[model samples]
Target: MSDMRGEVILRVVPRPADINSNGHIFGGWVLSQMDIAGGIVAGRIAKGAVATVAIESMKFISPILLGDLVSVYAHAERRGRTSVAIRIDVVATRGGGAETVDLTSGVFTFVALDENHRPRLLPDA
Candidate 1:
């Protein structure tokens, strides 16, 4: 992974329950973390309610093993009138030396929402 300028949004350890049959952390679990991280960044940018509109792209670079300390990082990558794209990256620190591995990366899109849950204009940055 290249130098990511995103902020650390979440840090979690994968439990045994998160492991798949293949002995790796479930991909769905990583995806959930990415979504949560993206939402947090989007909400801060929107300064209000926001909803996930799409996961534009995702890449799994490495498998997350049990006992890995997973960190989700995210930043607002793009912004439109009412929508923002957040770039999310997941990294795993393993083997006690804290060797870092790039686990996954994704781009998630979110839209500012009004009280009625419809798209609303984003405020000036």
Candidate 2:
């Protein structure tokens, strides 16, 4: 199912190794997906490379299970001279795509990077 959260930046499925003893996907795995999604949006907005500087806020609303199609959505929420804040939301579709669960949501800040790996001013919007 489509959501109005933002652009669907990444879609993936968790592997068996990504699960914890509780049979749910590890939080780190989910966080990594969000970071990847945020970076993609940030890079597009910056028109160059970008690095994740910080996670302003994050909340895990539900667990992810194996065989679920995970979708990570992201959008630029705020922009600065050299940094942009991307709001990311993750959802898991399960039960043969009948149910969708909100897995996590966060706002990640990314800094535009130059060839020297240092922060650079973002491009015009």
The TM-scores of all predictions, comma-separated, are: 0.95, 0.95
Q: What clash count goes with each model?
A: 0, 0
Error of 1 at 4 (Å): 2.5
- Global lDDT scores for all candidate models: 0.92, 0.93
Model 2 TM-score on a 0 to 1 scale: 0.95
Per-residue lDDT of 2-103 in model 2, one digit per residue for the tens?
A: 445888999999999999989999999999999988999998999999999999999999989999999998888999999999999999999998998898
Query: What's every prediction's RMSD, in angstroms?
Result: 1.7, 1.2
User: Clashing residue pairs in candidate 1, if any?
Assistant: none
Candidate 1 deviant stretches above 4 angstroms: 1-3
Tens-digit lDDT track for model 1 on 1-125? 23564789999998999999999999999999988888899999999899999999999999999999999999988999999999998998999945999899989999999999999999999
